[model samples]
Target: MTDSKDLDQVRSEIDTLDQQLQELINRRAGLAQEVADIKMAEAQQARADGAESAEVVFYRPEREAQVLARIMERNQGPLPAKNVAAIFREIMSACLALERPMQVAYLGPEGTFTQAAAIKHFGHAVLDVSQDTIAGVFNQVESGQCNYGVVPVENSTEGMVNHTLDNFMDSGLQICGEVELRIHHHLLAAAHTSAADIVKIYTHQQTLAQCRDWLEAHWPQVEKIAVSSNAMGARLAASEPGAAAIGGDMAATQYELQRLAENIEDNPDNTTRFLIIGSEEVLPSGNDKTSIIVASRNRPGALFALLEPFRQAGVSLTRLDTRPSRTEKWAYVFFIEFEGHLRDPNVAAIVAQLEEQSILLKPLGSYPKAVI
Candidate 1:
């Protein structure tokens, strides 16, 4: 049995540790502010030396990823590594805000998973701007309205998001980072509504498909309506007495709806991967992934030829998907993701070989893999 005196002593020690931690964190924030000041001074000096506008970039995705990785690697604690990394992530985010506040754009009418991904990657210190469409999110970052944007790339169950892929074909924005989020969908209803009152269900088309098996097993007779977004469905359910919405926790909390059924997705391991977009190119982190769009000439074994270079270079290909080419009929462009920084000699050599074989080879920026 533990004595009350020992417990009190432990609590007192914890309080002392907390005070020290707070002081160290503030000191870290001060150092970050100094880093910003140095960068600004350098930029000003460059402009004075006859360079066209030397804009200082406060955020470095690669640097932050490295820091998070180190934190996770060094952690030896009662708390989980991921939990510790998350605590450090918020600390870094707050310190970065002190250096220069960041605005991030995400697809939303509010309460979307994309919005959650943006917050997960950039931390809540960032000002989140909601856009109706994925393209709108990209445009926000491209037009300098937001420093960065978060958009869904693919789902484990639903495959690629074609709209996001198509936008990348023309956009000059670089991929700065990636985020993978485990999706747990819920069936939600207003406080006054009940399962017996749910005559109709509303959800985004993709989400509806994800929850199709569960819906068919339980609520087969209920009318399922697919809306533009899950957040939109939550809106309709809030207004209609006989309606319920299928969405994530964010949507339920945002709309003040109660969960009727939780973890209702057809697949238990359903996850979505989101890409962070920005104008600045990221330097190589130790662990990185490169994304590219390549249009191979229409010929025998063109697909094999396009991928052979990666195999030959001993580099692992992470993902490959095809999109219809806009310039030519029956021709498709390949979106290739692979494990390596483009700066690596072997990766650069592979790119050179691909350029020769491909009619169009666009090296979408290499970015650090998701940290948390």
Candidate 2:
């Protein structure tokens, strides 16, 4: 669009701009290294696979999402969401480098949703291990073999994962954190398949529950196979024609299986909540929750003493469950979840009162509630 003189002048300006950009990028990298060093102490001791720990901790997606959301709310930028997210991803990667690595355990044989959730929360920064059971996951963290453990607490379709609840009562693990994963299911097959030809479906018992109505109506005559894990079912389905597996999209892709159907879950809004447990206590967010197991002496006023403090503190009690106590007849452990942290003055005062009066008191850790 211009002459020789103009072209030369433009080239000179372009070179200047390139130099500035290079300097800015170099400065950013230096800052990242400096920040990563600070986080190294914590992340370094973490048990997650070394490479995963580096990436996940280094790039904290959740915190970045929160910050970028706030920035957009304020709207003082030329950056788009993706660009901003990317920038912060780099920044968080630096931040993670500042702390020691975190190790997280899960119930698994691999490619399980719990593993996915652990990765989601910890960012690929953790050492992910699949134990034989939920109790094992809890015990691993409790014994300090791992930094944290992830276990399913509840699912919208499956009610509660009772195995985890039972472990909660039996173990000394703290609920350090929580996360919800939006579940998506795929109909996977090893052989070529079509919806009309699929007669049998293989999946986990929980997955079966999620798709009960659909399965009953769609393939009433076919046998429903319950497998140990969705990935295992998917692997089975891949080897057999006329059979299909209900699992996440990743499993389907992992085996190079074609998806006969997607979004097969009956409820479009289904989600699962997972717990992160650690051996030690957690620092509470300003807005926090506390869970405790209260066992009172069989006397009349014992239960009342525990309830009175909560009422006085203006705490909202969300849940209370009575479980058979291991020790005595007619005695039960009343597991309670309430709004407020152990560190809150009012909550601490109530806990102190409960300690003196209750036969057994277990503080299950104060943590931020899952938002989504």
Candidate 3:
């Protein structure tokens, strides 16, 4: 038999800790409210002084990134670092909401992975607006209908989101932050579905490709259909007989479907990288990354001329992608991502050199690297 006195003592300690945490959280919220009031006053003063550009923006991506990083760094816990950071995320979200609720747009119809990424980066306190297309997400943010937008940029299993990359060519929105999500696809069906009766499978093209091997091995005879989003696949499967959808656990749960198989992806460590888009430029948070698009002249060694500056400066390049330039035939625009903020001296020099050599150079924005 368990010791009743010992159990009671432990429970009492936990209760005390919970009460203390609640009190501290509320105190933090009160401070956030005061900060908001001060910011409003400052904005009013700026307007009165005829400073048209000085607007009060509550959401600071760099600051939030630094805070999350500090929380992860200081963690010495029985619980995992991410779990602790996630708890703090909700606390910060609630406090920020006390200042002002943020509105974020994402590629979605709800239950999509982009929506999950938005919540992960912004926390659940912000309002989430779902758009049917990547263009829609960008357009909403650009039109001031939403403060920010989250869109998939690349996948570890798949290479890159071409549409998102292309959209950056014309959009004026900035890359404010980023989030990486570990994707695990599940084979889900409705409650009444039977394995033997399944004749068609539904999923996003990327999801279908990710699980190509498994599906080919098990359900080779079943017809695979590509949908706009995984959430759409789940919705279709829920209403159609003898239909199964390959999607994430979130979609399965949202559609009330049963998981016939879990982690059916071809690769075990599949992850998708998402970018947060907004209008404001973020200040440096110590560790940062800058993304840019460069179009070189149509000549020999054009690419080499564009990249030589970074090599000369000994800057670390994280990613480089090439897309056809919409304005020029047989010419391409290179999307490059590198470490260090644009404000850094070495990085600034390198960018200046590249601008001198390249036909066109556009700095997307510099923001802190992903913390969680």
Winner by lDDT:
1
lDDT for each residue of candidate 2 in 1-372, tens digit (9 for 90 to 100) = 544568778899999999997788667767767766766755665535455544224443234445545554554567665455445544444345445555679977577788878766666645688887887898888888887899988888877777777788778778877778988887777656777777788899999989888878777888889988887887788888888888986677766788777888999999998887876666665556788888998887777777998898788997776778889987888888899889888889989999998888889888766532
RMSD of candidates 1 onward, in order = 1.2, 7.1, 1.5
Q: What value does the lDDT take at residue 274 in candidate 3?
A: 96
Clashing pairs in 3: none
Residue pairs with backbone overlap in model 1: none
- Backbone N/Cα/C clashes per model: 0, 28, 0
Cα error of candidate 1 at position 365, Å: 1.0
Predicted structure 1, TM vs. truth? 0.98
- Over 1-372, each residue of candidate 3 has an lDDT whose tens digit, in order, gives 464568779899999999998899899999999999999999999989999687899989888888888999999988889899999999999899998898999999788999999999989999999999999999999999999999999999889899999899899999999999999999999999989989999999999999999999999999999999999999999999999999887798889999999999999999999999999999999999999999988999988888888899889999999999989888899999999998999999999888888888999999889888
Ten-residue region with minimum lDDT total, candidate 3: 1-10
Question: If both were scored by lDDT, which would come out higher, candidate 1 or candidate 2?
Answer: 1
**Of 2 and 3, which scores higher on TM-score?**
3
Question: How high is the lDDT of residue 127 in model 1?
Answer: 94
